[model samples]
Target: MSSSTPNKVPSSPPASPFKLALCQTPVTLDKEENIAVARDYLMRAAAAGASLAVLPECFNCPYDTACFREYAEELPAVGFKPTEDHSSPSLKMLRQTAQETKMFIVGGSVPEIANDGNIYNSSLSVSPDGTVVAKHRKAHLFDIDVPGGIRFKESDVLSPGGSATAFFAPEIDCTVGVGICYDVRFPELAMLQARELGAKVLVFPGAFNMTTGPAHWELLLRGRALDNQVFVAACSPSRSEGGDGYTAWGHSMVVDPWGTVLASADEKPALVVTTIDLGRLDTVRKSIPTSQQRREDIYRLQSVP
Candidate 1:
């Protein structure tokens, strides 16, 4: 069996559709440099007519398991509040860029310091008006010893999110499901957003290593989209050499409801843009009706043996 379980599919129809942009870029040690790169890519996405742009996980810092302390920042206040002056400079730049672009931006996953001084890997969605629409803590920590000998104990420095987050995007005309890096490995979280929250577009900000990305990245993404009949998009941080002492397999992609890889970025700094047709989602759902064709009677609730 795979290390993680698959997400569940929703038993309903999509309310709407939207254009998406996937920003795939390399992270740099210099905070300002990284922001500049992200801003540039985001502009390209906006120019390409994407209503929303999603960034990669830890786009602001190295994805090293050990650098969480040096890079972590306190969650900004409710509004356009900036991270403290001494806080991560990347946070300030992201907030400012979102306001300027007038486009909804999902600031992939970042290291956030909670009020209680505990650190959590978190993601935030920013509206064009600069309001923080949704804040999602990563539910499934990337804690595993990969078969190739790579080990990631994300739980050591971060706390898991207690609930799923689904938010409305006026531009998309539908709700969105939020996820980060390793969270995509758990399909239950995706199902919670698609089935319970009625999200049509599932967004994930991820950084997978070459060890696993080549093996499971695309498989997992296509599986989720096929099962849920909803669009799946992921922004991935580009590989780097400095702090992480690790390399990321940056195959950022956008998959359609029919499990098609509509667009993808292959091992480079690039912008992936794709148009989502909501009507097609409904068409597929009607044909398959997997959500409604349930064997609920057979899979009845039962206690663990």
Candidate 2:
């Protein structure tokens, strides 16, 4: 909601506009082909003049719990770049694509093998120079049972992350918060990113199943955008071929500060490109001023020790 923005100290205001691309490509069992497909789409997005490009959750692997560990990849050490000798194939591709395209990339969510021998659903924001600017392991592991509708437990194989994640994206001149699918359900994380970290744009790479997608996906995104007074973009993979026990709701979209859908894609493999300006967010915040009216004396929402 207000400070130094997502990763770096401010040099100027994000009062200008920039183009964003959301790649809603289809996920397949073959990891090599998936990476290749994402690479091709990302290059096209850059050619289309997007300063930033995003991919869907689990773009490199299947979404099922049983398949997590099988496709898990060890991440690079902090402050280091991924390489053929040190990084997973997926990360290597991401780094290469970011460098090749000269565009900031939100690599969506992937299964990561941590040092503790646990797997986590993680998202990474890579700069145009191929540096990993931000990394967010999902803080909220979705464990929902909708009786006859759906029952999936991410906690079955994934460990929850411990902190909020945001970074100052020099490419877009704003602090951008990165969150995976289930993390979008919790407003606390978004509030932390927007208020505490000064994130102006929040990106969520989600894969909502048909059972929940049509009912709440867009509504949740719109709510987050409206309440936080920030731009929000969510990317979802296309509906699976055989569904592989889970079929995604393929509607990747972007919402404005006023809860308006700027650009969106239906249930098919597609690319969505739209322009975003932090100037609009500033206008909304100036008119509403909810960030200044919070009664912090009564209660405060903050990170717990």
Candidate 3:
């Protein structure tokens, strides 16, 4: 395999010991109510000294594929003329909440209406000053069917994002990569962010269901962290039994560079907090030197520009 770096690699990783809050909130039918609860959790996280707060996938709406189109709202285009009316209720609330809390907010995956009129499962990262720093549409759409288990085809209604996303988090003095739901299944995305973009953390806002959650949730989190020697965090919606739509597997967690579970939440509405130490990242990289010792002459991974 050949690997390519479409963007310039960072010279070094960012500073460490940043506090992160994973808000595993309940997702109700009422979008407004859900946003309200998310806002409350963000405030609580900030008050508790977290500089970064992450929400679960589809936090403002039901995770049913059928509901994506209904909940889809226009997102402000990057560098577009006269800023469009930030009329999308979800976007408005997220922006305002980030500003009010004075914390970086990873507004989790929302059904977004793109300029091309397509819907995408997208995540947005907002700065403490309420500016959108980065946006990542789920690159790997969740499309799976397990016999007598579960079936979900996000591709039926949503389009996959074209590029990997990583942006600097001034609050934490580090770079973070944003991914949604199924995007966590692809290790290349994490590798690109950690190895190429110098991202110290990868935040995935996913809603894995009963079938895959119990089987691979923790395993995947730890695997990614160990492989990249970076912090990996997954924020999931709280489980809801007997719900009409998808039943989320809620065990939101954060893993360290050494593949240790720093903090994890049970299958309930919770605000899981953890401190990510950049020093550990440096220690791991120095001890193993896996990233620098790669056999590029034998095999390589190519990045898509």
The prediction achieving the highest TM-score against the true structure is 2
User: Model 2: residues >4 Å from true position, as ranges?
Assistant: 1-14, 82-85
lDDT of 1 by residue, 1-305 (tens): 11111234333454355678999988866656777888888888888888889999987777876777778877654344433343545555566777677778888877888888888888877777766677888888988897755877888888887667767776557678888878888887787778767788899999988788998999999998987899999889876654437688898999989999999988888888988887777888998998898687876322121
Query: Backbone clashes per model, in order?
Result: 2, 7, 8
Worst 10 residues of 3 by lDDT: 1-10
Candidate 2, which ten residues in sequence have the lowest lDDT sum?
A: 1-10
Q: What is the lDDT of residue 122 in candidate 1?
A: 81
Candidate 2, residues 253-299, lDDT tens digits: the string is 99999999999999999999999987898799899999999999998
Candidate 1 overall lDDT versus native: 0.78
All candidates: TM-score: 0.87, 0.95, 0.93
List where candidate 1 sits over 4 angstroms from the true fold: 1-17, 77-91, 241-244, 300-305
- List candidate 3 segments past 4 Å from native: 1-16, 78-85
Please give the CA lDDT of all the candidate structures: 0.78, 0.87, 0.84
Which candidate should be chosen as best, given lDDT against the real structure?
2
